[model samples]
Target: MSKKKKIAILGCGWVGNALKTKMEEQGHEVNCLCRDINMDSLVGFYNCDALIIAVPPSDEYLDVIEDVYFSVSLNEAINTQMILLSSLSFYDNDKLIADAEELAKIKDENTVILRLGELMGYDRIAGENTAGKMTNDSTTNYVHRDDVIGVIEIIIDKNVRNKIFNVVAPIQSTKKEIFTQNSKKFNFKEPSFSNIIDKNNSYSSDILCDVLGYKFQKENVQDFWS
Candidate 1:
């Protein structure tokens, strides 16, 4: 565990909120940037040891960073390390990937971007959304919430900067495959998958583990489905 330090998370939705609690349990102080725009949380962001941008990318994507620096970019204390929680949505679209890379460059060494895959863990599998989302051959990436927490913690500890890490499971499996294998555990019928698999957008998160020397506990989607 790292020394206790102030960690300001910009968005405190499901993932971020869970991360805050996990970090705090490990002894780090975390504060969510909620409604208090004028508070020191955002205005004096540099005061914190780390800042995490957990919002999803949208039309207002640029405004997120703009608003953060609108008040205190000029301050000498604006050297706090930042982590941007991005998604693998950048992979399928070349232009989207280019735009995300361009946007990350603006922050330079102070920013660390993580392109996460579909997050699965804590009974988030085999639900309403999983039964009919993809084909048998539609391979997709996924990352456990535990792995996400571990990656963020290590990045902060190692002071990883000016980098983009792909956070995902080592194996890419389709929804049909996932459900077919785990249907018995859930007492549900197995989903039939096609012999065809979508290979275009398939990704491997092996690089993060290789670079950071971290092991993923959630190797199979079936592990978290129950």
Candidate 2:
């Protein structure tokens, strides 16, 4: 019988833990790297084949680089392929990731950088104001955690080489839409949005689907919440 492909998950906090559980269930050897590895007894168990970096975004580029470095160090057993869970914020107006992008380019081969948008699952967007949530003015790109990790699995299965892939749902929603629908679902008052509000927007799942044949599971956020 063929052995299972090993996959490592770094920063197993929220999304990382979910990815680890999903990946392992498919019979892939899973290794999880965490900030508090000592506290968690299950640190260095499996022979990891691909390293999935599930850390969140930060304003500081150096911190991103540091986290990536730490993730790379954890894979001593295999020539672990690197998957950096970067953000669409990298493509923002400020371009805060200029330094990080340069670093990523240097080690492009055998690495896949997933530039995901605002993730919508659990506490990530739970606190948004449901009442008076603004919808039309500001637009945000969101993806379910399942879709995001699914894209990662595709990248691994296809042996997707060095490149950036945006793993987002097809539909875009404004804060008003999200909060208003959420409020209605929970039997609360409708939410509203302000004219001054600005949100990040992008095309969803095209590169992953059209190019890599990966499908995004979350079609819309409204379905997930409402």
Candidate 3:
């Protein structure tokens, strides 16, 4: 029988909470870190074994590292392994590699960094940056939230560690292709086509299945709706 591991999650919002519930369902003791002091009720649940950071992308995120908050949060459980839920936003084609590297520099060497791409959903972000820019002529990576959590579970089961990996669909699809697919499913107007790289930076990852043995839930990303 496998021993149950204790897990601590920082910034347990939508994705973080999902991970916590998933891990707990697998018999692991889970703890969460939140900004609010009223969350003290959760402190009794998790001491530490593995720390999973689910914070969003932001300039101030690096400040968490400088503060050694993660390292100190676990207190006596300092030897815990870490899984940083980072984003492709940090990958500014090596320009931000320094910051990216810093985020994974926990005290332990068993840390794994999973950098995700633009997630596609019908939620608020759907109408924001990506949805507005998607075109039949444009090709990009979009991973679903369910797929994101699934890949993480797969990694935990295999005990993959000490590397950087991209959690994206295998096939790249344009915005129009995805939207059209969704429109067909939901019966909406066929979105127009355009070519635009809104962000000044372009980031890409090559090692996912090569190192971690993680295949995304979907092969074709052509059906994603942003």
Best by lDDT: 1
TM value for model 3: 0.74
> Deviation in angstroms for 148 in model 3?
1.7
lDDT of 3 by residue, 107-187 (tens): 545678888877764452322333334343545667777677777776666667787777777777555555656655665
Ranking by TM-score: 1, 2, 3
Name model 3 segments beyond 4 Å from true: 36-46, 68-70, 73-78, 93-100, 106-109, 121-137, 195-206, 223-226
lDDT of 1 by residue, 34-89 (tens): 54556754455446777787876677666676565443344556566778888887
Kindly give the stretch of ten consecutive residues in candidate 1 with the minimal lDDT sum: 127-136
1 versus 3: better TM-score goes to: 1
TM-score for candidate 2, please give it: 0.79
**Model 2: per-residue lDDT, tens digit, 81-144?**
6787877777774455555655665654556788777777765553254444444446667788
* CA lDDT, candidate 3, residue 136: 33
* lDDT, candidates in the order shown: 0.72, 0.67, 0.63
Each candidate's clash count? 2, 13, 0
